[model samples]
Target chain A: MAAKQNQENLPVVLVYRRPQFNLPHRNRLSRHFILLDPADSQEPTSSFLSTYAQSVRALLCVGYSTITSETLSLLPSLELIVACSAGVDHIDLQECHRRGIAITNASVAFAEDVADLAVGLLIDVLRKISGADRFVRGGLWPVMGDYPLGSKLGGKRVGIVGFGSIGSEVAKRLVAFGCSIAYNSRRRKPSVPFPYHANVRGLAADSDILILCCALTEETHHMINEGVMTSLGKEGVIINVGRGSLIDEKELVQFLVQGKIGGAGLDVFENEPDVPKELFSLDNVVLSPHRAVFTPESLEALIDLTSANLKAFFSNKPLKSLVEIEL
Target chain B: MAAKQNQENLPVVLVYRRPQFNLPHRNRLSRHFILLDPADSQEPTSSFLSTYAQSVRALLCVGYSTITSETLSLLPSLELIVACSAGVDHIDLQECHRRGIAITNASVAFAEDVADLAVGLLIDVLRKISGADRFVRGGLWPVMGDYPLGSKLGGKRVGIVGFGSIGSEVAKRLVAFGCSIAYNSRRRKPSVPFPYHANVRGLAADSDILILCCALTEETHHMINEGVMTSLGKEGVIINVGRGSLIDEKELVQFLVQGKIGGAGLDVFENEPDVPKELFSLDNVVLSPHRAVFTPESLEALIDLTSANLKAFFSNKPLKSLVEIEL
Candidate 1:
């Protein structure tokens, strides 16, 4: 009866998730907010949202569910969006900006995991860890003499695309391995010690390895294209832990096939789960199923962060990891 | 004529390498020393050594060529043995100790590369980087909904078996990843900040991961046996960048096959060019053909260090990485 009374006084927050996606930490979240999930209703999603979530002040966006302007129209009272993903490409940022709806993301939760994967991929590519494992599994080591020597990570110049939390974490880890860090971001960060380039092409030209960890914004889409690859040169390696659309996939395939680029460790693709068949045969490439930020620890952290953001917003306290509105 | 005079004036150094093994940085070393290689002679190794290398004061032991008492007997005037490998197990240290011959190894040259590999293997195992790549390459990602999430490296308790150069380097890199480090060396290092364990079992019991980076000696061989693995428990991971003999291979295979231990990332196996066939099919273990210290950069460093050590010995200067013989 006490719990029910407490729940009755809690703020109403609509849970915006796909039908297949389950809201993590549902039990923990239910204590502070009355979560209005359309998936749990007998009525259609549109009817369910129009009936109960019309007056919802906060919406928690789960996974990559598209948050269109039309969806925003349904929740007229929605003042805040707490995203469970680090990247906000699916969320209609412009629409939210127009309505003055504050946004917070799971960047702090996902940054370290993404950064860990990025460094892992870089080391895997440079040292041929995956390739060597494949060779050993294939029983080719005795038949074939020595596995070809891999490049050392120490003293390599690494250029990071997107000097955000994830990119900064990667730079921090790689610095310990003696890599020189440089970055290209939307704007130069004045206090950062790493040298910054205004453009991806300029960064690629100066780097032995290029790690992509940026957002999939319209201006940044296909940012690592043919020209960037050409500048990166044949000996350069690419590690993409960011959104798939960050690189022109077709151009990357061509470059990799032609040996125009040395190697790649890709977690994301332009079309995920449908990787280029050509890449499957390349020993120089490591393909992951877009799981850079999906560790159990990070997922748990995401849940806590999502709930915390929503709680902070309700209490009129400062939000953690808020997305800066350009407008 | 001047070049010829310079070559003749250079100190004679006997190069003892396997017949199939070509010395790296040969050109660089040749400029500084009169390299007497038996592999270049039509005469047998013993005969060649007796004829030309009898008075050779310095011997460069390359590529794990055994420097036994018989081999050392060939060079009675041998003052110093400069090893091209980090581990001196291949060299007869006892014989060198009895003869009062100083020894230097490429530990300083190989430390960074070996450490890089140790960390690489740890990340590969923990994050399933190689396994995920295999899944994507085998076209299993789309068929399988999602690859299983790997454990996060952050907050993992990593216990290093050695506190030498390579082990220390591994600790340094892992610290940046937020892994708390402890170590078990032959003796506790007074200078190192990480907590020390007197035995492998103690370290294993406290650690989530055990990394083997110590030299393979009679006392240290098979140190990470059943007891250590048992202490490590079912979820523990072992990353070996040290010699294969540091682990009991049969026990490891059994533990892995039975799920008694979590996973492993093995670079050196008990037998080179021949890994256990059972391990070939296991997804939990990553196998590399003992090439951890063979990076092109490290190999280059090895050659430079070998030349430096030999030059230092002949010039009466202190050696860069002299092995302190246990008297």
Candidate 2:
């Protein structure tokens, strides 16, 4: 829905964090005297509502920090709730509907950076690059080392679990590696140029490498389980740039120990920051802490798009990624 | 010169080190009561013999070993000298030429393995996979550490020096990365599809990365000097898979230290087993002990092909890669 147009000195409170306004186009959100650090009391810092709830006609916050119905009730004047992050999982949609507030997000800027990470992890696994480096630096070369043997990625089968924007971008990068691409999603994306598999297990079975790039929803939660791991061939590798909840952590650990699958490269885990010790034991795995979309370019794009998204909301234009208001 | 068609049994001395032969065709030399380790303490090894003065009609030897003409003068029966390596640089070629002896070398089998190493080094440098692993494993991650950043080679400009068989194979593998290829050689080889540069420095300046794939010779000695390194841009990366003598070690070190050139990947060093200590200080350089052609596949091929070359020599057929004799 288009934002309501009431442009006569409408007081709007900028939410949690603001982008650095040092560039050429910095005054996009200047008219809305932003509450830079909104909630400094209950959360101690980095929350928006605790400080400016009374005067907040509009609440601009990120998706991670909580935005409760109680917090919205305090902002009785809040008309727009714009989330800076892509996902709206943390927002209370039911409350937003009751309060008659509009919600929008920044998402498109994330896909490119996330997809680059996915492809980089894939190459890291196939080439045994991480393992070799450890071998070399540990003074293992010509000492405690075996041959640095590995197969090239010029002719391998790659299976992508999601056919969304990010997954398709991953496929495009893998295409340059001369690998065949196969993907599985909820339904076949008709416009997709590559082959689609109806089942993730089958995709894993046919593929030399399996990449997880799907969204984290109830249907995909713990989808890569024991069966999926077993179905993957002996030399199969797994790369997950998607949510950690998509994988069954216990089953992954067991598979890694038995070498049921060749290796894995993970940017996320079942829990944020609470990784198992066994995962680090195996030299075959490469791990990152859910920061795939953390490039400088991606961050700037996200802030610009999110600011534009908020500006569009206040100006009564159709929002880019609108969701139900959690009033 | 052809092998004698009807020769009586004679004492044949194998005076040097070579890979063990398991070929049935080597029996051609066996008819003359061939010796595996000749007890000629006073005689020269295979490399230092005259064409007609040595008692041994044929010699089999590895690279980096010596053969002398003084020993050849004591025998008065030498006819041929064969190398079990691709390079026959240590052999006394002109002395043998003066006496009409034939020399053959094994070259083709070693090309593929070296080419594989060149490509492996290329990927290792561009991806920065090694450095990433080091950062993660050093307890630098979970709380605080720098990210492992790298650039993709999807559209980089690659310049190859000494575009021979190995160089061309590297080009084939790099094509999958969507890289544009430029090359420098003694003369333009029309068979290759890539563009040729008349000047080496011009090629270095134009390329995003430079690769050395040429043989070691006087005309090409120290070709990659301070001037060539300066020609490369600050972000340019260089990979050397050819002979170490082709590059100036001190210049490369200085360029890398000053960041005049971005990085270097060296499979061969100017001196074997002794890498410069300064190179170890820089994270940008990757050093390997001249074993680009040390894979199992290439090792087997080298041995099998050398045996074949030896067999062909005793069977009165033209030998492949006859260095000291006319082809």
Candidate 3:
């Protein structure tokens, strides 16, 4: 570990408020490396970054932390900056590139985990397994109610928006369920197995299942608007495992209320941890607190992969998944 | 269709309540088969027995409705009786055999469906998908406490009892999730992919996930008693899709409360439709109202297969699954 760290001094840095990762490990990082934590100062131990900035390079950070052009001017050794999480809106990527410092991100790492969760959420919601548990637990068994029987995954049409790594992985699992796949990307990839549509409304019109797998890019923000919901057939089910900002929560609630779509499985919301209160009375939606990447297997894979990337970076090797920042 | 039924005059009358013969075209069979709408009648339709009884070589049935000796005596032409469901306790197999009758059952038909539900139930239970949905529907989100994070199915050790068709199917799916499989049957089948044990205690001792997939017979009743529970390790999970009689519900509840076993996913209950209210408060367990084989795909398969059997029977061919009642 020591030999790898000393091989080359990693100058640029970015960090996020993630559940894992600890301080003793952070302290062991090279003092010459720029450090940034996206989480607001919720933990007293996170304040160690201010004192360590003297020998730092450049910062692409989040939350209460800031990286001004003045701070950029102070660090003569500063070269590049990157955000650790998917959203770069939190980081001043433009300013970093304006100062000739490259910017990057850790977006693709979560693709598979999020995609897996999307499929799982879709299955759970459609099957009504959770409601059955609630019914049994409530001691309301044999009460003779209209329990919903579920449909098979086989022979269903699934539409995915944003044909990125996560979208592709989700496509793979759905294939195993016997579903016919389709997707819509900013620009169509001719190599994809499923039919790629030109627009979100086209995908919605064709799909029985609509999946939001796109990132929270500006043009993509709130892309799941009222029009798209109307296009998705009345029996269609939507699953969102992407950025909360990508969906129009109000529109979703309205659609759910009117039964515009059969059901929805959401891991993210417009304002998460503060989901729209109006969404609570609808029996057609399944909700998760934006947690698709937290599975133990995925977590272990994520840490090991990220650790490998860091180790490689410190060893003067080309970094993996280098996010391109426009200068 | 009428002419075909007359030509195929089934020698042994196998009565499966809600046989789903019309699932493919539910609306189509409104006039053909002697449909026994359990909702409309507490007793088997008189026309059902009378139409097929005169030439009825045997009586094949299930436990949904009472089948008394008098009912059996009514069919003087009865020579054999087979049950389509797994359990024979509901049928007076003794009286049938005493009357020199034979029997058979589609014992393994529901295995695949049950196994599918078992996995679904476990995932839903552990992930608290239903609870999240309820929270979202009840307008409690966006002002919420904690969003439930689900566990992954991969890397768990699955223990199966009665290593039969359903148990084997469960093992197959669990293996896909990267789980190590172990099972106990009356005797192990060497060709199976999983490791087999001689007793339930051995299976429980090593498994992280213990499942009940055995038939409900005298020898297997209450097999998952206190000793079996103790052997299943403290962190183990149990899923029962076999029979209610196999588990002691009171003991299971106690063990769950005491944290002896991690959780349970139950489809059948000792006294179903009357599940304990205490079960609902705990977040660990998932419950289904014995509706595992109620999926559209399975329902279609059941109807198609049963219709095929009926067709074959009237054609003077032997039945597909013949159980030896006289043996």
Candidate 4:
């Protein structure tokens, strides 16, 4: 009876998420707050939000569900959005800014796992780990003599796109493998030691490997296009752990099929779960099903971070992982 | 011609290797010395060595050809043996010691590439890079939903077997990934910061990952056996970039099949080019056909080091990568 009374007295938090994004692990969120989830109710999301979330000051957005201006208008009392992902591109930054709403993302929680996968993908491409495994599994080793030699990872110049938390971690790990690092971002970070390129093409031209670790936004969509691939040259490799739309998929396919680009390790495709069928036959490419940031450790960290952010907002304390909304 | 005369005047260095091991890159060694290859002659190896290599003071042993006492007896004038591979197990070290012959190996050249592959294989197993690639290639992503989440690389307890050049290099790379390292070797390296286990089983008991980087010797053969595997627990991963015989392959396969051991990343096997068929279907294991140390860059470095060692031996200078013979 005491526990039920305490739960009823807890601060209310509106949970906004798509049906597919509903995870069982998220039930932990209800321990500290009264979560008002429309999915749990019979009414439509808009009607449910209009009924119970009218007085809700905080909203937790799950996965990549887009929060448009129309959705924002429904939650008139929402002062903060706690994003359960590293990227906030799906959220209406302009509308949120107009409504004087604050935003926080899971970059701090996802950075290490994302960076680890980026390095793993880069190594897999350069060393042909996946290709060699296929050769051995196909029982070709006894007949084919030795598998072809892979390129050395040491002494390669790696150019990272985005000098964000994940990009910085990738640089740190690759440096230990004897790779020199450079990066391209919206702006040059003062404290980072790696040389910065103002554009992706310049970074590609100077790098033996180009890794994408940035957010997907209007200016950054399709940033890795034909010109960038050409600049990366025939010997360069690309590793993408960011959003699929960051690269122009059609041009990338042509470049890969034509052998214009050396290889690719793609975790994100322009249209995921629908990767280019052409890439299926290529041994030089390693295709992952957009799982770089989905490690159990990182997911557990994300849950803790999301709960902390909500608690901070309700307790009149400073929020964590706040994104600087560009005007 | 002046060049022809200079080549004729160069000191003799006998090249002993199987026909398959005759690499084109080794022709570079001919510039500095007269390479008297027994395989180049129609005469039997013993007859050829006795005839043309009577005055040869240095012998270059290529690949993993067994240099027995009988072969050593044929080369009466051989004062030094230059091994073109990392492990000198195939060379008659006891016979070489008895004859007061010095030894050199390509460990210095192969260490970085071997270390790179070891880390690549570890990442492949943990992140399921190869498994995920297969899933994406088989067009299963769209139908199967999300691929299963992989364990994080960071915070893993890694135990390195052998603290030699390759082992040290592996440690350097894994440290950047936030893995805690411990090591077991013939002798504890005083300068290494990682805790040393006096035995393999103890190391396995504490580590989430055990990497084999030691040489194959009488005492070290089948070092990773049933006892060590059990101590490693069901969640422990094994990575062998050292040699195949270092592990009991039959036991390893059984453990993997029964889920008594977690996973494995094998570059070397108990038998070359012929891996156990049972491992082919296992997703947790990453297989490479004994090509971990065969990167183009590493091969180039080996050629340079081999030539340098031969030149140093002829000129009475200290040889590079000299193997310390245990008396």
Please, what are the lDDT tens digits per residue for candidate 3 over residues A1-327? 885666454554545343343322354443544455534355442344444444554443422144556555555556545444444555455666776665445556556557657776887667766666666665566675436677656568999998877788788766655579999988889789789899999889988898888767667889988888889978889899877777788888878888877888888887766777666655567777767655545545544445545555557677665665533
TM-score of each: 0.98, 0.68, 0.81, 0.97
Give the winner by TM-score: 1
Q: What C-alpha RMSD does candidate 3 show over the true interface residues after superposing them?
A: 2.8
Candidate 2 has a DockQ of 0.16
List of clashing residue pairs for candidate 4? B244-B269
Model 2 C-alpha lDDT per residue in residues B1-327, reported as the tens digit of each score: 135543434445464652232332345445553555533344443334443224567766655465667655654666777665555556666668777877766556666556656665665566554554455555556666345555556568999998866788778766754579999988898898899999899999899999998767667789998888888878899999887778899888888898888888787778655566677667777666555654444555565665566666668788766763322
Backbone collision count in every prediction? 0, 14, 27, 1
Candidate 1, which CAPRI tier? high
- Off by more than 4 A, model 1: B1-3
Q: Ignoring the other chain, what TM-score does chain B have in each prediction?
A: 0.97, 0.81, 0.79, 0.96
Report the TM-score of candidate 3, chain A only. Answer: 0.79
Candidate 1, residues A1-327: lDDT per residue as tens digits? 997888889999999998867787799888788988888878998888788887899999998899999899888999999999988989999999999899898888999999999999988998899999999999899999799889999999999999989999999999999999999998999979999999999999999999999888888899999999999999999999998899999999999999999999999988778899999999999999998987888778898899889989999999988997663
Which lDDT tens digits does candidate 3 get at residues B169-242?
77766664456888888887988877888988888888877888887776788999999899986777888888
Across B49-160, the per-residue lDDT of candidate 4 in tens digits comes to 7778777899889988789999888888889999999999998888899999999999889899999989999988998999999999999999999888889998999999
- Report the candidate with higher lDDT, 2 versus 3: 2
Mind giving the per-residue lDDT tens digits that candidate 1 earns over B1-327? 998987889999999999877898699988888999999989999999889987899998888888899988888899999999999999999999998899998888989989988898888888899999999998998798689889899999999998899999999999999999999988888899999999999999999999999989888889989999999999999999989999999999999999999999999988888999999888888898898886887787888889889888999999999997664
On the 0 to 100 scale, the lDDT of residue A250 in model 3 is: 82
Best of the two (1, 3) by TM-score: 1
Please give me the total number of clashing residue pairs in predicted model 1.
0
Indicate the DockQ of the complex predicted as candidate 4: 0.87
